[model samples]
Target: VQESEIGTAPDKTSTAFIPKQNEQNVLNDILSSLHLTPMDVYAADNTCAAGSKLTERHTFFPPFLNSSVARTKTLVHISELSKLHSAKRVVSDETFQDLCDSIESTGIYLYTPIYDSVNPRMPLPLRYECRQFPRASGYVEDPATGIAAAALACSLRKHNQRYFETNNDIVPHHEHTNSYDRFEFYQGTAMGRPSKITIRFVENKDQHCDDTTAVKRTTTRMLCSGLV
Candidate 1:
């Protein structure tokens, strides 16, 4: 009879797989096959300079916060947000690299928010999972970002208004609808660090309905727990 060793090896350990330059294209192709839609990009200026306080400590802000702590920072917008079953997901390496390049080229921050659409038990419409790239700091990802979240909320509000206006029927029926939009977001799982963020958009009743530009200016509040 042959004796068999059933126990596991004591020193067995797992190793991380690092991709090589030659295989990058193949890896990018595989990632691209995972059903990601190309996003529309836009540019905006950071309305607040609070990020200056953050940069004072050698910390970095999203590209939207601009490279410096100036009054207005350039912000890059990647709209047409997508939804995923889980917050933990991946995008094409090429897409990610392009985003990084855009940040370098535009000198702004990039924000992408993916959500879970099927979970009905959750009170919110969807669970927001956001990823932010800060190329200026030489970091590929930030665990969490309030500025990005706020920027996203602002973008969504503008999109919503445009959607209603284009429908024709909805606008005439509900002019100046004072509705509050709430969003709950999660981030940092991509880096093994988890964070939760909450965002709220409250439209000011005094907002000028006559001017489309005025409608773009709305109030947004963001709450989060973690280092942005």
Candidate 2:
């Protein structure tokens, strides 16, 4: 929030979010619900105002299974999902199986959904459609993600590595971050634009790392903006 960023008194929107009174309790609740803690709550002022979007992170543990530090990659797409309406109904729980399975080994997941359109002026428009299913979602797994960047950087630092491996040759793998963020869908890498940024553990020596390459672009994804 920089003062210089506001020059013409751009219409500002503010909404109060219900904060968690207890962290551990919320975490327990998430586990019970097959959901996760650290969920974001969104809101707005009026019908003319944009609606709020919340991203709820979750985890999944295979029945009778165990591990250390978790082997899963980033499970951050759940909270970024939109209030999807299809010719049918909310995607069947089975439709989410792949997502759930992907996060299975590691036990970490996220669910982000938008209730309104980006303009915040009218009820959010349902634009994206699925060829086989009915829902909208986004996955985050790259350095361009500001919030994940620091965590990713920390992971690199922890493992005594600094290299990331990805299938997208367009990506340089070792990306930098600009700021803390949740806008990954609209983020960029050397491999052109990708919907997801799958991160791999790489070793590095820097105890403290700061990268901002992700923030260099405009995040057009409403999920990133947290505006529905």
lDDT of all the models against the reference?
A: 0.37, 0.25
Alpha-carbon lDDT of model 1: 0.37
lDDT per residue as tens, model 2, 1-228: 100100011112423222234333432332333322222212222122232321110011111111223232232222223311111222344444443343242222232323334444322221211111111224222213333322332332222121111212121222332111121222332224323433233323333335843323222211222111
Candidate 2: Cα lDDT at 89: 21
- The TM-score measured for candidate 1 stands at 0.40
- Tens digit per residue, CA lDDT, model 1, 147-228: 6555555444444454444544232112222122555566675667877766655445455666356554554443333443
Least accurate 10 contiguous residues by lDDT in model 2: 1-10
Clashes of 1: 3
